[model samples]
Target: MLSLAGWSVLIQASLAAIPSYVMQCAYLPGKILDGVDRVNRNFLWGSSDSAKKVNWVGWDKVTKSKEERGLRLHSAKGRNIALLAKLNWRFQIESEALWVKVLKMKYSIKRGRDIFNKGSRWLVGKDSGLNVWHSNWTNGGSLRKLIHGPITQEASFLEVKDIMLDTGWDWGKIPFEISLEIKRMIQAIPVTILSRGAGKLIWAGSPQGTFDLRSAYRLAMGNNMVFNKKNRNSSLALEIVRQALEYYHCVASPRLQTCKVLKGIRWERLPQGWMKLNTDGSANGNPGLAGCGGVIRNDAGQWVVGFSKCIDITSSFVAELWGLREGLILCCNLYITSLEIELDAKVIVDILNKPAYVNNIISPILDDCRLLASRIPQIRVKHCFRQANRCADSLARMSVSLDSVFSSFHSSPVDLLDVFEDDFNGVNVNKLCPEPDVPL
Candidate 1:
C-alpha cells in the first residue's frame, strides 16, 4: 500500500495530469475542499496573467472575483457538458429506460454512503487524525466502521452536506437572499391586506392618483416589470408598492362591468347561488340584418326568462351593448337582487370600468349602463369565455329567422309554419329547428 505522503503526491499528480478542459468542466467555483487543498494549494493561489497563460490558478482567481462581484462566469464548453448531463439525468427519469438503471446506480455511488464513505474516511484518516495515538481507534476507526455499511446513514449525511456546500445552497452570505426575502415580504403584505377584503382602504388614492396607479400597475405587470421606473414615473420603491396595490385591488374586487351597446336582454338561474343574465346581438353589415337575444336565470338553475329579437341595428358592438342593457333592465324588472352579467367583449368591459370623457359615440351609452348598474345591489358584470355562452349565441342567431319572430308570446307553443306561412311555403319549422346537434 502507498504511504500517506506517497498517496498525497499521487493525488496531486493525478489532478495535475487532468486535462485543462476536464478540470474546467468539473470545477464548481464555490465547493468546499476535501483533503487535497494542502497538496494542491496552487488550485486556490492564482496567477497574475490568465489571458496569455491558461493557468488553473488564474482561472480560480477570476471565478472567485466574479462570484464576489455578484456575477457568474461560465466556460462555454463546461456549461455545455453540464447542461448535457442535466438533460441526460432528466431523460433517464422521464423515459425510465434501461439507462435509468445506470443513472440510478451512478447517483447511488455519488450520493450513497457506502462508496463515498470509504473514500472520505480514507482521506480524513490519512490527514486529520493521522498523528493521534488513539486517533485510528477513536475518530478514524469509528468513522471507517460507520461508513462501511452498504446503506451507511452517516455517508448520506456527509454527501448531502457536500452537495449543499458545492451548490452554495446555504443562504447565509448571498446578497440575493436579502433582496429575495424583501420581495417575498412585500408580496405577502398585499396578499394579506386583500384577503381581509380591504378594498376601500387600499384604493384610497386621489382620483388622479388612482388613475396614475392603475396606469402604472397596468404598464408594469402587463409589460412584466416588478419595479418599473420608466413607466411608473416614480421611485423604484414606489413602483413596487404600486404593483402590490394593483395586485391587491384585482384580488379584492371581483365585480365586472357590462358593455354599453347590446340591445337584447335575458336572465337565467345558475346552479351556484347567483343569477346570470346573458345577452347577445348580431348585425349583418354595419347595422344591417341585426338580431339580439337575452336569457335570465336565478341561482337555482331555473330559467327565469328568455328574450330574442331581430333589430335594425348598426354594429355588432352596438348589439352587444344593447344586449347588456336589456339584461340589466330585466334583472331590475324582476326584482332579482344578486346578479352576474356575462359577455365575451373585452373592449366593452374595459370601457365600462374606465369611461373616457372624450367626444365618443359610445361614451354616453356606456355611462348609462354604469349608472344603471351602480343603482342595483350586488350586480357584477364579467367577461365570459365564448364557449360558456353558446346557448345565448344560438338564440341570437335563431331570432334572425323571420318565422321564429311572429311566433313569439303565444301562451301556447306555435308551429314554425304558422308564423311565416308565405316564407315556409311547405317546409316544416319544427324540422328546421333540428335539435341543435352539438352538445352545450
Candidate 2:
C-alpha cells in the first residue's frame, strides 16, 4: 500500500502531467468522470472507498480555495473551463491565426441575424459590424423583435456609429421615425467611450471583458448572481473590507496572499413565527427536461419538508414559478399561517409582488400561487441569493436525475445533510459576487 506521502506525490504528479490540450478540448463522458473521481479518491486517502479510510475533509471542500473554506485543490469542472478559457483568450489576441481567420469567415456578423448565436456576441466599440435592427449589441435580443414597423431603405446597412454624435447617441440622426419604446430601447443600449479598436466579439455570459475559467464554470453550473437593493449594505461592507486589505500588508499571510478573504454572504432564518420556503427549478436546456424543488423550514430553523418533481418541457422561469406554486400549496395544506417564499429568480418575484402586472405565459400559475398565498394569514414572496437556498437547489438538481415524477423527503436525505447543516448554522456556501470590470 502506498504511504500517505506517496499518495500525495502521486496525486500532484497526475495533475501536473495531465495534457493541457485534452483539458481544453475534451468534454469527459460520465463514465470517464466517474473513473477519474475514483482515481482521485484512491490517491487522496490510499483507498477508493470512504468506508475503509476517512477523507478527513470532504472532496468538495478540498477542491475549493481557502477563502471558500477549502483546501485549494482544483475541481475537474473548474480546471476544464480554466483550460478552455485559454483558447477563448487565444482567439482574442491572435486574430491573425489561420484558425481565427477561418472562424471569422464562417461566423461573419450579419445584421439582425444570429443575434442569439451560442458562442459570443460582438461588443459595439466602433459599431462597424452592428446593425440598428438585428444585432444584440444594444440590450439583449434583436431590436427588430421589439419594433412594430419596418425600417426605411436608408436605414439598411447603417452601422451603430451613424446614430452617434461624438460621445453619445444622436437620436435626430436616425433616418426613420422612432417610437417611445424604440427610444427607450436605444437609450438602454449603452455606448461606452471606445478607447481603441472597432468592436470585438465577446462571450455574452461572461461579465469580465476577458475570458476566465471561473465565469465559464458558473455558466456551466447554471449558477446566477442575484442582486437586490437590500444587498447594497452587504456589498458596501465587502467593498470597505477589500479596500482596507489592499492597503494593509501586515495582516496578510502566505495563504492570504494566494487567497484573499473576500466578503461572503450567509443564510438567515425567517423572523419569529414565520416559516421560510425556498423554491428552485432546473432544466437541462432552457426548455428541455425540467424539474422543480422546494424546501420549507420553521422559524426555529428545523426542516419541515422538502419536495422534488419532474415537470414537462418548460422554460426555467416558468419552472421556478411552478416550484413556488407547489410549495405554497404544500404550505396551505399544512395550515401554515405565516409563510415567507424565497426564490432566486428576480423576475418572478417582481411579477408576483406587482398588483397590476400580468404575464400571459405565467398568469395561470401566478393566480394559483396568489390564491394560495392569500389564504395564509401572513405571506410574502421575496427574492434571495441562490447561495442561501442550497437545500432547494440540491433538490432541483436531483429532480433531473431521478426517474420518478415526484419525491418528498420527510427527513433530510444523506446527500442533503451538509446543505441542511449549513443552512441551520448560517454557514455560507456558493456565494458569488459580481465580476469586476477589466481595465480598458
Candidate 3:
C-alpha cells in the first residue's frame, strides 16, 4: 500500500520516534536497537513477513544528517550519549542544585578533616620535606611557639633540608636563640639525609603514624596544644616502657626467675677441694652511695677471706661488677685453684655468662673479672637469691659506714655472725613476692 518515499516518512514518524524518545531518558541495548533498525529497513523497502528485499543503504549512513546525502534518522546509541553528556554539564553548572549539594556532602571534607589536619605530621624521608618552624614534626606540634624572640630574616624560610647533613643533624644550623630545652628536644629527633624527594605526611594520631578517626576525635576534644602534646607523650612513654620490659625479660628473666618462698632455697657447704665465694653489692640509691662485699669459704663452711669496699656513687651494675672483680683478684692472689662464685644479682650473672658488652664505664671491671676467671684452673659462676646470700649482703651494706676504700676481715664480723651461722646450718627464711618486711 505504501511507496518508497511514503515508507520512509512512515518509518521516521512512527518507528524511529518511539526508540528515539526512550534513548533520551536511558540507553537501549545495541541488539534491541538493531532489531528496530531491521524493521525500519524492511518497511522502507516494502518487504514483509512473507518476503524480504535488499537494503540499499547501510543503517549507519541512513542515520546521518540530510547533508550527508542519506535519509536523516535518529541513532539510538548516539541519542543516549548526547543526553548523558548534557545532563552531566547541567549538574556541574547548577551549583545550587539538589544533586550538587548531595555530592558535596558525600565527598567534601568537613570539620573532621580540620581535626585530621591538626593530627597530621611529616615523616622525614628527604631533606626538603618539612619546613622547620611551620611543619608539625616536633612532638606532634610545631616549633612555632617553642621558639623564642623574633625569627631572623635569613632563617624565616628555613627548611629541614638546610639543617641536615650526611653524617647526621647539622648542629651549626641550629639557632642559639631558642631555649636549651627546645634545642635538646630537636636534637633528640634523628634526621637522615639519605632519602630523595619531599617526604610524605603521616597521621601522628596513631602509633604507626596512620590517620584514624578515633585519635582524631580525641585530639579534637583536647583542650589545647599542651593537652594534645601530653597525649602524644603518653603514647611515646608506653612504647618506650614496652621495649624496656622486653629487653629486661630477655636478659634478666632467665637468670632471676626464682622461687617465691625461701623454703625452696638455702646456702650449702662446698665440696672438698672446692671453695665457695659469695659476693653482693648495694646502693643507697641506684646511682647513689654504693659498695661491694665478698666472702670466700671452705668445705667446712668456715670463712677463708672476707672483703668490703666502699665504691663512690655509681649504678648498681657497676657496683656488682666491682664486687665480682675484687673476689676474682683475691682468689688469684691466694692461688685458690678450684672455686665456685655466687652472686644474688641476676643481671651480673647474665653479664658474666654472656659475652661482655662494650661499656665506657663498666667494661674495664668486667674485662678484669673475665680475665681473672680464665686464669683459675676451675670456676663456676651462678645466680643465688638474697636468702642464700645474706652474709655477703650484710657486709656490703656495712661498707656505707666504712671510711676506707677497701677493708678485709679474716674472722667473721660480729654483725654478720647470725647470717654466717645460719648459712653454716643451712637455715631458710620465708622470702616471697609482695614480700612483707622484705626488699623487692
Candidate 4:
C-alpha cells in the first residue's frame, strides 16, 4: 500500500503529465480538466470503486505549494494558462524563430501581444532612435497620448535626444512648457546607451528584463491570490494532511542511504598552448565594500601574473565584472593571444557570451570586457566551481581588507601561497557529496 507521500510522487510523475503536453499549445475543455482533477483527487485519497473516501480539503488547496500548506500539484487550468503565456512571451521576444515567423504569416497573432506590451517598455540606449513623444518608452503609453494638449507639428517631431544631456535631462533644450511633475517623471526614467548595439524592448516586471512564466502567471492571476475554504475543523484537517505527508518521508519513498562519498574537485590546468585565467569577486555585504581579484596561470598551473583591487561600495555582480575587466586588460597589455577565462559566477560568463542580452548598468564594464576580448584572437570563457578557483577567491577576499587601490603581483601573494601551491601540485580538495538513497 502506497503512503500519502508516495501517492503524491506517483501523481506528480505519472498522472499529472497526461494533460501537460496538450495544455501548453491548446486549451483543454472545462469538462476534460474537471475529469482529470476528479481522478487525481480520487487517486490521492486512495478512493476505490468499492469504497469512496471523502475529500477532507478542497482540490484547490491540494494544488497549492508547501508554503501554502499543500502538496504543490498544479491545477490543470492554471498550468495551461501559465504555459501558454510562456509561448506568448517567446513569440514577442523571438520574432525571428521559424515557428513565430510561420505563425505570423499564417495568422495575425494579436491575442496576448497587446497585454504583454502594456507591461513592457524600451530599454533605452542613446535616445536618438526613440521619439520623445511617439516612442513606447514610458510606463503604459506614448508621451503624445499621455500628454493632454496637442502641440505644433515641428514641436511634436522632437526626438528623445534633443531634450537629453550627458548627465541628465536638458531642461533648456525642452521646447514646450511641461509641468514640474512631468519633468520629474521624465528625469526618473533611465536613458542608458551601451558601447555596442541599440536600445531593445524588455519586460518591466523582471529585473533581468526578460519575461518569466512565474512572474507572468503571477501578474496574470493577480499577486494576492488567497484560497479560502469553507469547512469545519479546517486547521485540524490541514494538520492531519501534514502529518500524513511526513509519515512516509523517512521510511517510505525517501529511503535515504548514508554513505560518505569523496567529491574531488581540483583546479584544472589549461591546454599546452593556452593560458588560464581564474577571477573572483567578493563583498562584505551585497552593496557594502566590494573588491575583485584574479590570477593568470600557464598550462602547468604556474602563476604568471595576478591582481587585486578594492572597489568602494557596489554590487557583487559589478565587483565580479571589475575583476574580469582587470584580467582582460592585463591579458591585452601582455599580448596573451590564446586565453581561457574561468569564474565562479556563471551569470557573468553568460552575459559575456551573449552580447545581445544587454543590461544598461553593467554595459560599460561589459563593453570593456568585450572590447578587450575582441583584441585577443583566441579566447574561451568558462564557469568553474568555487572550490576549483580557491586561489583567486582568497585573493578577492583579501582585497576587501586593503585600501581602495589596484595592486598587481608578479609572483603568488604571500597569504595565497598555500592554495596556489596546492593548485600547482594538482592537489584535490575534499568535498562531501550528499548520501545516496538506500533502496528497500
lDDT: worst 10-residue window of model 2: 223-232
Per-residue error (Å), model 2, residue 165: 61
- In TM-score terms, candidate 2 sits at 0.40
Clashes (backbone N, CA, C under 3 Å), per candidate, total 24, 1, 0, 0
For every candidate in turn, the CA RMSD to the true structure comes to: 27.8, 22.6, 26.8, 10.2
Candidate 1 C-alpha lDDT tens digits along 93-148: 35567766666666532221221121111111111223212122221233233332
Q: Candidate order by lDDT, highest to lowest?
A: 4, 3, 2, 1
| Superposed model 2: Cα runs more than 4 Å off | 1-261, 430-440
| Candidate of highest lDDT | 4
**What is the alpha-carbon lDDT for the whole of candidate 3?**
0.68
Candidate 2 residues 187-270, lDDT tens each? Answer: 433233313345655554543334445545443433322111022233566677878887575556433323334556666887
User: What's the lDDT for candidate 4?
Assistant: 0.74
Off by over 4 Å in 3: 1-262, 433-440
At residue 166, candidate 3 shows an lDDT of 52
TM-score of 1: 0.31
Better of 2 and 3 by TM-score: 3
Candidate that scores best on TM-score: 4
